[model samples]
Target: MTRDKHDFKKVVPFAFLIFTIAEFIPVLAYFFPSSLPRNVLTYSQKRKLIEKRDSIRIQIHTHINNSAKTNKGSDNAPLISQRDFINSTNARLVSKKYASSFDLSKTADFKTAKLMCKFFGLSSIGTFSMLKSRLAAHATFLRTDDSLLFKDLDSTVAGLSTVQLIEACDSRGIPTTNFSFPHLKNSLVGWVQFSNSFSTIEPGFYLWSRIFLLSKIPTTN
Candidate 1:
C-alpha cells in the first residue's frame, strides 16, 4: 500500500507540470506571432507626409505675396486693400483658428485662400461679410501693415475648412445677426455682441482688438 501511494504522488506532480506547460504554450503564441512582423510607418510614408505639408505651405506664401503687391500703393497705404483684406482675413481665421499649425514662412496663397474658406464659415456671403467686418476691426486696431497682416491673415484663413469654422463659432455660443443685402446670401451677417456686464467698452471695438491680439502670437506646430 505504501509503495502504491508513493507512485500516485509522483504521477500527480508530473501531470500538473504537463498541464502548466500546455497552458503556457497558447498564451505565448498569442503575444508573439510567428508568421508576421509588426506593421510600422515606413520612411517613405513619412517622407510623403512631409512633402504634402510643404506643398500647402508654399501655396499660402504665394497668395499673401501676390495680394500684398496688388495693393501696394493706394489711399489705403497702411490700410489693407479691400480685396487683400478679404483674402487675408479669411486666411487668418481659418489657419489660426481651424487648421493644423504649419510653418507660416513656407505657405503659398491658394493654400491660404482654401484654408480661409474652410475655417471662417465663409461658404455664403453673409458669413463672409461677418468675417470681413471682424477682420477690418482687427486691422484697424493693430494699424497693421497690409502686407504683414495679409500673411498672417492668409495663414489663418487657409487653416480651416468652411464647415469646421462654422461649427467652432457655434460651439463658442457667439450670436449671429441678420441683415438684408441684395448681393449677399441669406442677407444675414453674424456679429458677436459685447456684454456691458464684462466691460464698458463697445462690444464691436473690443472684439476687434481681440482679433488683433491673436494675430501677433507666433504660429504653433
Candidate 2:
C-alpha cells in the first residue's frame, strides 16, 4: 500500500505539467480567452498582424504623403485644425497603469489653468471655468499625434502589430477610425513617409504645463 501511494503522487505531478503546457497554445487561448492577457498580443497573433501590414505598405505611403501635401497649402501647417484632429482620436488613450496619474480636476485654479489651455490652442476665443478648459486641454493633448513621426518611408516604420498600433496611438493621441485592418495599415505607412512642416506637436502632454503635475511635489495655500 505504501509503494502504490508513492507511485500515484509522481504520476499526478507529470499529468499536471502536460495540462499546463497544452492550455497555453494558440488554439487553447481562444477557448480560454480569460487566461490570456486581453490587450497584449501573443507571438502568433503579432506575426499575423505584421504580415498583413507589410502586404499593403505602398497604399499607405502614397495616401499619407499626398494627403499631407494637399492639406498643407500655403502656411507650413496642416489644414486640419489641431483641436479638431486631436478630438477625433480615440478617447481611451491612457493605459490603466498610468491612468491614475492623470490629474484632470477642479482643484486646479482659474486664471493660471486657462492661460495654459489657450497657449496649447485647445479652445475657441475664450472659455468657461478653468475645469472645463483643463479637461478640454488634457483631451486635446492626449489626442494630438503624428504618423510614424513623419519620418522617411523607406526606413523601418510600420513595424507595430495591431494591438501595438492601438496602444501607441492611444498613448500619443493619433487619429484612427473604424477602417479595415488593411486600410488602416496603408494609411499609417503613407502618413509616416510624407515629409511635412505640419507645425503640429506629435508627442503631446509632456509639455502641457497644466494637465499633469508632479504628484510628489508639495502644494501650499
Candidate 3:
C-alpha cells in the first residue's frame, strides 16, 4: 500500500505539469500566430521602379515641348513667314499625334497648339494652308464690318502659309507686307490670318496664344 501511494504521488506531479502545459498552449497560440508576409521591398526593385517613373515623365515632357516648338517658333525665332508657320503647324500635328499616343495631356509644358492639332487631325500641309486661307477671310470680314474679330491672331498666323496669306491681304487691299527672316513682325494682316484660323476651331490655349500674338501687333486704329 505504501509503495503504491508513493508511485501515485510521483505520477500526480507529472500529470499536473502536463495539464499546465496543455492550458498554456491555447493562450500562446492566441497571442502569436504564424509569421506574416514582409512589407519591405529590395533596394534594387525600388530603384528600378523609380527609374521607370522618371523616364516616363521625361518622355511625356519632351513630346509636349516638341509639339509646341514644331508648331510655333522658338522664343528667339518667332515665326514671321507664313510658309514657315504652315510648315511648322503641319510638322507639329504629326509630332503631337505621335506624342499623344503616350498621353500628352499628362506632360508639363504642354502647348495648346498640339492639343488643337490632335483634336482636329490637321496633319497635312494642304489642310493647314486651306485652313489659313479661311481664317484670312474671317479677318477681312471683321476688319470691314468692324465686328468682334475672333480674339487672337498670333496663333492663327502660326498656322498659315505665306503665299495664301499674302494673297488674301492683297485682295483685301491690306498693305503688302514683309517679315524679317528670323524676327518676323506681327502685323494686322498676320493677326487677321490668326483670327480667321481660330474662329474655325474650338477655343483653347493654342487658340488663345494665336489671339495673344495677333493682339500684340501695332494697330493703326
Every candidate's CA RMSD:
25.3, 18.9, 30.5
Q: Which ten residues in a row have the lowest lDDT in candidate 2?
A: 212-221
For candidate 3, write residues 17-126 as lDDT tens digits. Answer: 45777565334333321111111223433334333333433343345445445554456542322222233354244334444332323333334333333222222133
Off by over 4 Å in 2: 1-148, 172-178, 190-195, 199-221
User: Which ranges of candidate 3 are over 4 A from the true structure?
Assistant: 1-149, 177-185, 189-221
Prediction 3 TM-score vs. true:
0.20
lDDT of each: 0.30, 0.36, 0.34
Candidate closest to the true structure, highest TM-score: 2
lDDT of 1 by residue, 1-221 (tens): 01112124345544564577756533433442221111122344423433343343345434544564565446656233222212334434433442332322223444333443322222212343444443333323322222232344435434645433332232222211221121111111111111111222332323322222221221211
- Residue-level error in angstroms, candidate 2, position 139: 9.6
Arranged by lDDT with the best first, the candidates are 2, 3, 1
Candidate scoring better on TM-score of 1 and 3: 1
Worst 10 residues of 1 by lDDT: 182-191
Reference-based lDDT, residue 114, model 3: 35
Q: lDDT: which is higher, 2 or 3? A: 2
RMSD to native, candidate 3: 30.5
Using TM-score as the measure, name the better of candidate 2 and candidate 3: 2
